[model samples]
Target: MDAFFASVEQLDHPEYRGKPLAVGGNRERGVVAAASYEARKFGVRSAMPSRLAAQKCPNLIFVPPRFDRYKEISRVIRKIFLEFTDLVEPLSLDEAFLDVTNNHFAFPYATQIAKAIRHRIFLETGLTASAGISYNKFLAKVASDLNKPNGQAVIPPEKAEAFLEKLPIEKFFGIGKVTAEKMKALGIHCGRDLKAYSLVFLTRRFGKSGRHYYDIVRGIHESEVKPDRIRKSLGVENTFEKDLLTSSSVAETLTNKILPEFFRRLQQSQTAGRTLTLKIKYNDFTVHTRSRTFPEAIPPGSMEALALELIRQEELSGPVRLLGISLSNLIRPDDPGRQLRFSY
Candidate 1:
């Protein structure tokens, strides 16, 4: 789906069509969920503070998020994907990876399937979508975004190298700001530069992620498209609009701000964690994490207790830009080696 939340709002309200609209919470604490291309021109973007977004686009119309409606449309779009193949791995509500190697569709090639899928999406949901088609998951995933708003981009085997060569390292899946900067400093700004390094070197430098970077650079991804993906954790965090500079101010957030999020998710999942982790992300995007294990198992009452206890152990020596707690000691067999993977 293209501009999924904003498109849904526009579909439901004709007045918002082709206008600079934003779909998100309409509060100072809220961030943009999606921004129309019209809004993007003014430096508006997803995750931008709502108040800051308002300053960027003075006339930007904010549409409150309709999660229920978005979920319904997501189901509709996923249904269309299943029509072609069962090998569909949904990435959030708007994006998915479809494997058509042994597909039932009559389409002669991946590009044709992409075009048809885009057409079906627009016809069914009354919205546009962009698609990427390639021989492997890595290339295909990147191809999908090359074109946007009812467009398709296919990276045939011949063009795959050239396509990835010029692509920025950040554009690759799972690579974020911190890793991108690290890679850039190492003279790796794109796939071509990354290819010059050996897997052992990348692995030594970046741990497990180096292996992925090594293979993806050569267009040799072998990851499977999962269907019954179980969520292992449910969490929420806070990024203060202004810096939290004092211990008292930080303590207030653990009790008054962060603990509620853990409790809410704990209640919803009927699960709790014995290990608690505290994540403090600075304005520069640098992060410090601390975790601790407890003897008592997690219960509904213990969720907030664990968060507060974790907060108590933490030393807020400087200003905090973000504060987060995670209850991740979920004991599920499907998740392997998790018992030893305590975050705190």
Candidate 2:
């Protein structure tokens, strides 16, 4: 899927087509959930501040998200993916990893399956999707974005080493801003530079993740694509148009606005957890989180009380940018005894 949320909006509302648009909080302090290709040309991007996006593109149209519609469409896309292979691992509503090694279609090449999937998605959903075909998840993920909307890129085993050598460290999966800066300081700016470090040296510097970095740099990711992945947490967060300036305002929003939606999702999923985490992002972009793990599942009405307590514990340094709550250590309604694995 390309510009998934924004594309869906455009498909449903013809007026938004070929125009700079974003789907998310349409406020000065809100964050963009997704940006259309037209918006991307003006330096707008997902997770960017709405105010900054407006500054970049004065005519930018901000539309509230329709998650239910997106989810419905995502299910349609998933159906198309399953037609090819059962070993499909969805990373999000829009993106997934498919192991076409033993596809049901019996395609001669993975690239053929990729093409067919993309074609079927467009035919069924009236939206475009870009695909990447590779031997491993990391390369496939990176290659997927090399081309734009309705395109596909493939990295064969023979070309993997050369492909990685020229790739920038920042573009590699799992490398973030802080890690990229650290790598740059150590003169590790590209895949070739990353490959220069021994496994022991990388582990010494980056802890458990260092080994992962080393393996990916040499095009050796061995993780399997597991299907029917379990969701570890259920959360809902909101960004205000105006920063919440007082403790009272923050608490009120959490109780009156966020909690209802949160509970609705929990009920819909029929999942609950003993651990509740509170997330706060300040206007300055600094974030802090606090969590409490109870011995039992969070009972009805207790979540709000616990959330309020968590809020009281944190010292608000400035006007708050975002407020969210997540419940982890989840157990399904039908099987409360079985605990789901928590993933960060």
Candidate 3:
């Protein structure tokens, strides 16, 4: 999908087609969920403050998000993907990773499959899409974005390295603003620059993601697109629209805000963890995380303790826009004693 949420709005509203339009964030409290191409021309972008976007383009139209309709379109697009390969791993409601090593339609190539799918999407939903096909996830993700608005790009295995070489490090999916800035400061501005650093060096800087960066620069990624990527660590976090003046006030309110999520998930899993993690997504959306592992595993009943500990830690920091918690290093029910009342 390309410009998915906005495109869906355009498809359903004739007057919105080819007009500067956006979905989500029509209010002071909201952010841009998606921006149409016309909106993009005016410097409007996703995750930007909706108020600022309006200020940037006084004529920009902001439509309220319609998740139900988007979900319906997602289902329709998913069906199109399944026609070619059941090995489809949905990354979000609008995008997916498809393994077409052996496609059902027997399309001559992945480009053909991409074209057919795009065509079917237009025919069925009157919406445009773009696609990228490659031997692995990293290149494929890059390829998908190379062309836009019903376009397709394919990176053969032989050319993968060269293709990635010229790509900007910022365009690497996992590297957000903070990480990109860090890479730039280290004199890594693009794919070629990334490859200059040793794996040990990248790992030393990026922890677990360093290995991934090391392999992807040379187009040597083998990470599979798992259809069943479990909810390994369920958690919630927030990003505030404006800066907070105090930390303790936000800390006092965070549990009331975030603890419900844990309580809700505890209905489904054992909820044990060896670590209590804290993540803060600042006003600028630059995220920083802190974690403390415990000697005793976080019991399923420790949601309160976990929440309080996180709040205390956060109170000592400055204003925070987001708070997050996850029960890591979990042990399944069959191997452990029940410590809390749980549904599953």
- Top TM-score prediction, candidate number: 2
For residues 1-344, could you state the per-residue lDDT of candidate 2 as single tens digits? 99999999999999999999999867575889999999999999998988899999999999999989999999999988898899999999999999988889789998888888888888899999999889899999999999978899989899999999899999998899899999999999999999999999999999999999989988999999999677799999988777899999999999999999998887777777889999999989999998999887777467889999999996799999889999998776567465433221
In model 3, pairs of residues that clash are none
What clash count goes with each model?
2, 0, 0
Best by lDDT: 2
**Which stretches in model 1 have alpha-carbon errors above 4 Å?**
25-30, 106-108, 238-274, 278-290, 294-297, 315-324, 333-344
Better of 2 and 3 by TM-score: 2
Badly placed stretches (over 4 Å) of model 2 are 332-344
lDDT of 3 by residue, 1-344 (tens): 88999998988898999888878766564678999999999999998888889888888998988988999999999999898898899998999999988899887788888888889999998888899889889889988888887798889999988877888999987789999999999999999999999999999999999998999889877878787655456676554555555665555556676667665765656456667676776665566666777766665565566666665664444455566766666645555564544432
Clashing pairs in 1: 132-144, 291-344
Candidates 2 and 3 compared: the better one by lDDT is 2
How much is the lDDT of residue 44 in candidate 3?
A: 92
The residue-by-residue lDDT of candidate 1 on 162-199, one tens digit each, is 87788899999779889999999999999899999998
